[model samples]
Target chain A: MREVFQQSLRDVQDRLVLIAELVEQAITEATTAFGSSDVGIAEKVIDRVEEIEILAAELDQLTIDILARQQPVASDLRLMVGALRMSASLERMADLAQHIAQLARYRYPESAIPAGLTKTFARMGALDVEMARKIVDLLRTQDPRLIAEVRDLDDDLDELHAKVFEKVLSDNLAETPANVVDSTLASRYHERFGDHAVGIARQIQYFISGSLD
Target chain B: MREVFQQSLRDVQDRLVLIAELVEQAITEATTAFGSSDVGIAEKVIDRVEEIEILAAELDQLTIDILARQQPVASDLRLMVGALRMSASLERMADLAQHIAQLARYRYPESAIPAGLTKTFARMGALDVEMARKIVDLLRTQDPRLIAEVRDLDDDLDELHAKVFEKVLSDNLAETPANVVDSTLASRYHERFGDHAVGIARQIQYFISGSLD
Candidate 1:
């Protein structure tokens, strides 16, 4: 029975890693689509949202089933709770990626980055993609060091988020209201993607350290 | 043992209601501060965020304890899962409310509603506060009927969200980029608050009906 429970725990971990990989793929494609104005790639990311949601739902069911069958306690139970949260965060990361892709699709012929803010947006997108990659690694390996790495990445993302606002509010941009709205929303979506990444990292940290700090 | 589990379940329900009530107050005060540029009230809402978060964490620990102690299955198990999710939604609702209040505080003495969209923002704020109130009621009563009510309110809120974007993009507003940024973010925050409210309603629906639809 103990071995069986361990297998179920491994199953939970594998599923989380799978979902995180999908999230990484979604964000990578999403950033690429947003930066290059590639509508086709954006459509691909949009179409995968439902797939990620279904996978997340399945993962939740599996965790519930494990709790019912295995009744894991102590560290094992913490793993179950963390699995549920990590799945939710991973799913949210996918949704944010979809939102980013939709922005690119909305401005198919035109760029969503607005004038004078393209480089800033490019850096922001890169940061989000890197964060997603680190999340995938963190989930697979459960390395405590990656927790701080993800948090530091979020700090950088936050700074870029503030920079996006600063640039938009500055007089030198000469952007239209539409550009301002899109840039604001897009920057927010990117920043939120990083936040969700940090959320996942925190969950992993809690599961490993038995503390939420 | 069964009776003890029942009491624990009741405890879970009561805590959820308590957190929901706090969320309702947060959104109510937040929208009021947002509308009136009342920084004092906004600060009140901001200060309570940690309170809500702490309550949520305590609820999570209690649910985990229940799961470990009683090993509830089927409907009871669903309740535990739903409680975790509802707690998350309610906490997110509070965070969104804080964001709205921060906007008000940041633009103190200067309304964040921009020039032409004041009425629209007022309506949006009202919808959010109404949804928060309904969430508190739904958590307390577990009435499936409130689920539909919450969904409909979100629809109204979403329409207002779209209208805000429309007005922002229109030429007649003659607003600064800062105004555009604030309106976009404020509208998004309000919309997300409604989304979290809908999320809690859905969790209730699932607990009652055993279907996620």
Candidate 2:
């Protein structure tokens, strides 16, 4: 019985990694759509969000099933709870990625980001994709170093987002109000991507350190 | 043991209600600060968010404990999971309220909603408060009608948010860039409050109906 229970738990973990991979794909493609203003890629990213949501629901049901079957205590309990929390954060990250794709699609034939800041957004997108990929490994390995790297990358994303905000608010004064709004919203979407990743890391920290703070 | 497990579950529900009340107060105080441009009220709302966070964590820990000890299945399991999801949504709702308060603080001596759209924001605030109150009732009764009411309120918030966005984009063209940014961000914050509430209601609906969608 114990072996069977552990097997189910292993299944849950593998499914979680799968969800993270799907989220990474969403982020990469969404940002690709955003940077290039490619409606085709954006549509593909948007379609992928449904798959992420479906997987999230499936993982959720599996976690509940394992908890009922094992009635795990202490560390095992924490792992299950953490899985539920991380699933939520990953789901939100995918939704944010979809938001980025929608912005690209919304302004099709015209990039949501101005040309002057395109390079900045491109940098942000790369950092975001890297963050998503690292999180997949973090889930599989539970490495503290990976969490630290994600945090550092998040700080960089914040800095870049602020730069985008400053440029759009003042330096890009000649831009249309609609375009400015798009830039602001898109930058926010990217910033939230990092924020949700950091949130998932915190949940992992809670699992390891048992600190609620 | 069964009675004890049921008691713990009830405690979880009661604590969830308390968090909802705190969120309600935060939204009211935050909007009051926005409307009056009163930094004092805004600061109070910001401080209250910590209490909300603490309560949210407590609810999470308690839910995990109950699940581990009880191994609740079927409807009981759904109820516990729903509480977890609702607690998260409430915490986020409080954070959104804090964001509104921060905007008010950032633009000290100047109303965050702007004079032209003050009435629109004022209406949003009223609807937000009402929604929070309705959620409390919904949790207590699990009434489907209350869920419908919450959805209706969210629609109202979306409509008001759109008006604010339209006004800032065109009619309020003479406003300073910073003011326009603040208005856009604040309205988005309020809209998110409704979004989160609607999300919680959906979880409740799922709990009642066992529907994944």
Candidate 3:
């Protein structure tokens, strides 16, 4: 029974990695959809939303099962808890991707983003993808130092976001109301994407450091 | 040894409640400062920032110790994890109070919030305080239902904040540039506080359900 439960734990970890991969793919697809204005790609990303949710539910059930069946202790307990947290973070990341897709859909027909603002949004998306990739690596290695590095990287994303805001408010004073609001909300979506990415890093940190903060 | 570990876990839970109490007090002081334009009370909250930080650090250490020594499993493991998350949420709540205090200090003497916006800000603070209180109760009792209710309550806050923005953009057009900017930022801060409060609930939900959705 113990051997079987241990094998199941390993399987759940594999599922977690797969979920993380799917989440990263969704991020890439959604961002690509927005940057390239491909509604078709965006739709594909949105369709994966249910799959991500289902996998996340399964991950949760797996953790509960491991806890009840094997009563994991020491490193095994940490791994199960870590897997659960990583699953949650990945799910949130996927949701953010879906949100971006919806935003892309909203901007279909006519791209409302100003050139300066679009560059900022693009940078934001790149940072998000970068963050997500780093988090997955950290999970794979359980490297505490890598988890620590994420905050500084998040600072860069934040700085870029602030610069984007300044440029939008200053350079687009005379733009249409619709254009201004769309750009502002788009910037907000990008910022939130950064936030969710940071959240993933924090979850990884909790797994290693045993505290979220 | 098992009994000692169990007692330590209980101690950690007790400390979490204490931290929540401090957070509640800080929010009350900060909100009162905002509502009354009391610079003195705001100054006091700023001074208490370190206290919140220290309490958070102490709680973190306690959580790590429990995890390390007790090596808890099942429900016991969840309790420790919950304690860690609750501390994090409380720390952030205290920081939000400090942020509000800073805002109050910036707009000192001449209260920038116009009389018309008073009701909106007041309502925002009220909801925040209520949510903070609810989280504390949930932590105290290990109640599961409040976890879901926090999300529902947060929706009301979001609606209230939107109404605030609509009111400002529509009715406060004649206001001075400084006041307009300040009010906008103030409203944003309030909205963010609501977001953080909802976050505490999310942590509680994970504690109750052992899942993050």
Top TM-score prediction, candidate number: 1
Which model is ahead, 1 or 2, in terms of lDDT? Answer: 1
Per-residue error for B202 in candidate 3, Å, reads 7.4
How does each model score on lDDT?
A: 0.91, 0.86, 0.72
By lDDT, who's the top model here? 1
Best-fitting candidate, scored by DockQ: 1
Ten residues in sequence with the least summed lDDT for candidate 3 chain A = A171-180
C-alpha positional error of residue B207 in candidate 3 after TM-score superposition, expressed in Å: 8.2
Compute DockQ for each candidate against the true complex: 0.85, 0.57, 0.16
Task: Report interface Cα RMSD per prediction.
Answer: 0.7, 1.8, 4.6
lDDT of 3 at A194: 66
Chain B, model 1, TM-score against the native? 0.98
Q: What interface Cα RMSD is found for model 2?
A: 1.8
Q: Locate the minimum summed-lDDT window of 10 residues in model 2 chain A.
A: A171-180
Candidate 3 per-residue lDDT, tens place, A132-199, comes to: 77767765776777666777778887888667547655744444433444555555556666676676
